[model samples]
Target: MKKWALFLLMFLLFILLACNDEETNEHVSSDQEEHEKPEVRTTPSESSKPKTKPLPEMTWEHLVNQEEGKLTANLDVDEKMSDQLVETLEKEITALTDETNDPEQIYRGAVDLLASSYYQTYFEKASTYDPDFEEPYLPDPEIEKKEGKKASPKKAFILLDASSSMLLRVNGKIKMDIAKNAVQRFGEVIGQDSDLSLLVYGHLGSESSEDKQLSCEGIEEVYEMSPYDEETFQASLNSFESKGWTPLAGAIKEAANMSRDFTEDVTVYVVSDGVETCGGDPVAAAEAFTKDSKERKVHIIGFHVDETAENELKKVSDAGNGTYYPADNEEELQDTIQKRWLPSLADLAWAHTKAPGPWEVLGKLEELEKHTNKLTEVRQLETERLNTVYRLIRDHDLLSSEAREDLKALLDERDDEIRTLIKNLTDEKKEDINKQADDIKNRVSEWRDRMYELRDEERDHS
Candidate 1:
């Protein structure tokens, strides 16, 4: 019985040893599995990571819409945003160029972009000034006619600058030649019955400091203040050469002296290529000249002058309470003379009513007329730009089929916009002009009645 009990204890001890070895093997296997695995470490899932949103695809339509929004905004005249707007356009154009290697497409895009910028600038410039549309006071119409002769004939003094700058070539033609031709045309238009005079400066000497003295003293009334004579005017125009320093102030001073003696109203048209070169104060001279004479005005014409020169020249006109017209070429010069200068002459003539009140009213009407003319000229320029764009697209192979179609559509829209703006401006100007004309008519009728009352008062006193 003792041997059998010892055998059972030995068997249980063996079983216990086997169980311990198995447990040790399981621990080793677990360590090996951990080492063989990917360290049992955690990593972000694909769904857990942040994703980038794609950019919206750029297109021509999108760019057009953006520009349209910018242009349609109520912008001030002095807003300095053209540069930024141009930059945005350039970026869009660059993107378009990257997608298409077509030169035609690129060219059309560039031109259209340029046109858009130009029109915006022009529109802002035009809106800078408000038109003067106030009506003047009127007198009574039922008075008897005054027992006096009609008012003296109106006079126009053409102050032609024969400075050396006028000798410069514009459009392959001499500036002086263009100026002389314009003056001749003006003489013809004014006719023999009109009182026209020519006062030329810088016509006596060559362009030199030695000649400066003679040039400064060179102002000569070539044609006296008399009825227009074709032969006399032609001879006067032929008498001078474009030479020497500008004596603009001296010429104006001389003109003021001449105007002081005249019974009728005087309009001085100073056609110059530059400002006062002889150390003269033209603005002061102009102001002094127009101070006492209610009917006297000084108008300036800048022939082919740069911006600096234009600003300087504008001061003379501003001081004189007159308008400044800039001419860059022969065509522009002619337009300035005919549209601006000649019309002013006509208005002055009309203002020569015997009554003072009617004359003042007539002056206001003349101002309105000049403003309307300027707006008309701007509209014509826009029309020309529109026509030029159309011509380029229709007559040239400067655009691909797809580009041409898109550009045409865009231009058509632009054309419509410009046309609408021009029409609106025109209608407004016309309405103002009509109102001015009606006011003038009423004033003239009232002036006649006032004259009758004055004559009756005089007879009763006598």
Candidate 2:
């Protein structure tokens, strides 16, 4: 009986162990299947994607906001003006100012404001001035055939001033240093197909009377007129120091002589801090150069100079039939070189290929006329506004008798400034518009005659 009971217990234990082993095997198989399975990703439908909004258009107000502090800093508005009046003017004028309250920006803003306010009115008036006037259609001029070998590249003469005045500091930087940096940047950007010559003056001796003669004769063509070499140009720039009298006339004469040999157009750039200090007639020199070669233009840059010096330099540029740019800081220097000189150089280089047609010239003239008229209107409006403000202050009894007198004096000064500004704007507009119109009219007449000639030739042939 005991043996039978022990056998039953062993059978029961063996059955239980077998069942546990089977359960463990099934669990391991399930986990292995899960690990071996591949991942399946489902993409979202097209309708589920987010939409992107279009960018906002940039406006004058946007520009003002971007350069708020700098634009508003130089505004000449009086603190005693009524808050409402001030606010209105600020809103109107802020759009007219930019990051740099430079003269160029102010003039440009004034023109733009005028255009926005009075372009249509003037344009209509101009259209009625000549009802029978037909706009000209000008085709591109034919490229002149080049004989066997190609012509030499156009030449650019860069006259860098290294006078004692250039050593003075402007915005914490020496004017010479600023000029050097600007020229270096310009050199880097100028096209490789053009030849550049760098002539430096006023770098030989001290500012003493004994050294004046030596400095006056120190004009050196450090970089010869050839394909631009960055290393050589930089080395030449490093060799000079600002320590002598300005020999501007001598430099211009030498540059003009050097450019006389070139068949293509030549551009002369005189970077100076002041007029000729060595008692040379720079204006005459420029005039002679321009008269000698109609293809040559001399641009003068007054670097950190006073009004008197600026006016003196302007004479040289005017005589040379070129633009006079005044640069008070590094920013202005860069702007003048990049926007004015560089583009002019490019145009001269590609004149035969890309000169504006009669149609383009005519369109530009029309635009200039519209701008001029608008500027006139703007000046008138501004004057009226100023007078209204003055009257309002007086009528409101905004100050005591003594204070009123002082305010009146201030207003009178402001009025004088406005009148001067208006006069300048008017003169500039008249000169620019009249010159552009004359040029366009001549070109249009020539184009029309050419068209008629071509039509006659075709008819004869047919």
Candidate 3:
């Protein structure tokens, strides 16, 4: 019995020993498996890489240079993250390029971008404001060479009628307010080369002083055409409010001094709702003004006016040797002024009427008119085509598969009509352009003849 007990104890001890050994080996293997792969200590300096190229210093010349490589460099922006930044950069560049001659303005404009939406977020997070954050200035673009160099700055009188009629509401805002907004928008589009004057009529009360009345007349106490700076112009626009009658003729006559400046062509833009309150023929006044000087041309735009007003406005345009624009609404008014008037005026300014310069001012005017006609025709065709498609699509019944197919056929037909219209319009424009080219050639020949005649006269005098 003693031998049996001793043997059993020895067997149990051996089994326990084997089990303990196995547990120790398993723990060691598990630990080895957990730490077998290499440990990675990723520091930010190694992981967050820097860009290969440094950001370029913003300069006017660098930004505006149309050269492919230079443009690419200036435009090589991180489009995904920096659309606003890109816009800001472009605006700064344009503003700088435009106002290069004004050193103080250039300085202000350069830093203005830092205050823009793009940079504001970064700036707000900054601990301090840097007073010395000035961008390096660059010289202007080489003034483009021309046959006749004329850089005349034009003065334009914008006589906006802020009458009671304009006070009527449209599109969730008063018409006068909308007009005010539109004018403000136009101010933004106007070139640095021109000076603009803001005069609002019908805002004066009945018992107002002579000074106030004169101020509104485009003459009397007139706010003369001056440089387009934000503060003064914006103040004038903001202060304008509707009050009195539409004195259309008196306004034109008041601006007649503008006609006297033969050196610079004066343009008058009369923005009105088109009812003559103190009835004197505005057209007659315009005719008289043009006849007297033959230098000034007045443009009349009827802003959301009645049919009678439009007809009268057209007459005034004819009398003034100008174009009548019926800006039926705010959007049309905006488009008319920016896309047509401002650019035309800017080009005229480059003619420099100050001296007997060789700039083809008349030719430019004609070209502008032609461009307007072409654009108008194109727009009309496009609008007509769109309307036709819209009508067809909206009215077409598609209950059955056959009806659906029929509607599709109609859409195809409209598409064909649109294509035909486009082709016809394009061809017409081409022919018109060719005719204009021939006319220009003739005019050049005539001008050459006149020049030769003058030379002959000079020779005889000598």
Better of 1 and 3 by lDDT: 1
Give the per-residue Cα lDDT of candidate 3 at 15: 100
Residue pairs with colliding backbones in model 1 are 140-446, 141-446, 143-449, 144-452
TM-score of each: 0.41, 0.41, 0.39
lDDT of 1 at 113: 45
Clashes of 1: 4
lDDT of 1 by residue, 282-350 (tens): 999999988987677788999999899899999999888777999999777776654212123343345
lDDT of candidate 3 over 1-462, digit per residue (tens)? 999999999999999999999999999999998999788855346356443343234332222231322222232222221455445445445555443322223233333332112122222222121122111111111222222423323766777886567778767668887787677655544435667776667767642454345334432223446667767666778765787667788778767754465467666778888656665678888888778555567788888888887888899988997778888776677666643121233433432232222234344334444433443343343334323322332344212344334434543553465345435544554455455544544554444444455556657989
Q: What is the lDDT of residue 78 in candidate 2?
A: 21
Native-referenced Cα lDDT, model 1: 0.65
**What TM-score should be assigned to candidate 2?**
0.41
Off by over 4 Å in 2: 1-153, 339-462
Return the candidate ranking by lDDT, descending: 1, 2, 3
- lDDT (tens digit, per residue) of candidate 2 on 151-254: 22377888999999889998887889889978875665453446899999999998999999999999999988878787988888998899999999999999
Lowest-lDDT window of 10 residues in candidate 2?
140-149
Q: Report RMSD (Å) for each prediction in the order shown.
A: 17.5, 31.2, 25.5
